[model samples]
Target: MKKWLYVLGISGSLILTGCNGNAEDTNAETENQAEEKTEEVNEQQVKKEILKAQMELTNTFKPYQQKITAYQAAVSAEEPDSETIQSTGKEAKTAASEAASKVEDFTIEADLPEDVNTAFNDSLPSLQAYYEHVESALNENLEEADFTSAEEKFTEFNNQFNEIIEKAGFPAAPDLMEEMS
Candidate 1:
């Protein structure tokens, strides 16, 4: 009877030890899963921040583009001299450049996705190129040069600017029509 009792005690001890080991393993796995989930959430937050910054930068560019368009139209109507047109063009370029610099200064608190970052970095150079082209076109006398040609160049630049906005996945500016209604 004593022998049987001793055997039962040892068997029970072994079972309890096995159960404890299993429990510890389960807990460790749960902790690892929780840590991975937290990392995923952090990555998502960073992507959101990057998207927001891109949108703001695109929005700033729109107003500058609009101003350039208006200036171009004014120059077309009056056939301004080279110096006068160039001066106005320089002012517009300066404004655009300043806005671009501000966009560059925008800081993100989180890591940007590689693809999005590459796209954004590419946009800056294209924008700079468009600005240079516009400046060159504007420096010419409207009467001495082809007004249509200048308009075409402006249109091209505007299209490129809009393309950057599109690639950044930015939504169109909110329509005020609904609010007014």
Candidate 2:
């Protein structure tokens, strides 16, 4: 009877050990799933932050696009009306100045990755430079040269800005820039 009791005690302990192993496996699987979920959430959060920053930057620059198109039309007229040119040029100047002001006030409210934040922060200065060039150019006679200068400055900004956007893992920048002279 004592031997039988000893045997029963050993069997019960082995069964409990097996059951504990199964529980540990279940816990491991749950932990892995929770980790995956957390990673997915973080990825989505980063994406959202990137998108929000892009929109704000675009808005700051969009005002210039309209005035540029108007100025382009006025300059490229079949019979260039000095009156129209002067008015459009003034409007473009104002728009550029406004963009510069906006650039000064612009802030990225999103918490992005370190590299991405640096890239984004770097982009605004280029945009400000572009706006400053246009503002100064419009102070003189509106020439084809002024438009070309604006284009060059714009290209520089665009290249830098687009690279940052791509690095953030988004689609190509939408046609944010209009047809500039």
Candidate 3:
């Protein structure tokens, strides 16, 4: 009887030890899965933040883009009127100014990834410069504007805008001038 009791106690001890080992393994696996989930969530959040910022910036400039398109169409006509050019130019300049101001005042969420934030912040100056250049070119004599300088400014602006979008992993801005012309 004593031998039987001793064997029963040994078996119980082994069973408890096996259960504890399995529990530890399960706990470790759970922790690893949780950590992986957290990392995935963070990556997704960063992407979402970048996408949101891109959309906001695009929305702010959409009206200005439309105005520029209209101006381009007006100037492309067979007999472009000087008066129409002047008025449209003024309108385009105003729209550009408004878009620039909106960009200047743009804000990003603090929780965004540092690289995304840096890309956005770094692009602001170029964006402002591009807008200023466009505004100045639009104010020039229409004949002089046709002399390559305006095209250069447009190209520069497109390049800078594309740079910003690319840095943020966003789609390039639509080339309204190309479409309208």
Which has the greatest lDDT? 2
Tens digit of per-residue lDDT, candidate 2, span 92-160: 889888888888888898888898888878877877878888888887666552756666777777788
Candidate 2 residue pairs that clash: none
Q: Which stretches of candidate 3 lie over 4 Å from their true place?
A: 1-15, 109-111, 143-181
lDDT of 3: 0.68
| Model 2 worst lDDT run, 10 consecutive residues | 172-181
Question: How would you encode candidate 3's per-residue C-alpha lDDT over 5-100 as one tens digit per residue?
Answer: 999999999999999999999999999999999988887776677667656666667778678656766788799987887778788888767766
Error of 1 at 157 (Å): 13
Per-residue lDDT over 65-117 for candidate 1, one digit per residue giving the tens place of the 0 to 100 score? 66565556556765656665566566666655664465455443335667656
lDDT of 1 at 170: 51
Sort all candidates by lDDT, best to worst: 2, 3, 1
Q: Rank the candidates by TM-score, best first.
A: 2, 3, 1
Reference-based lDDT, residue 75, model 2? 88
Worst 10 residues of 1 by lDDT: 172-181
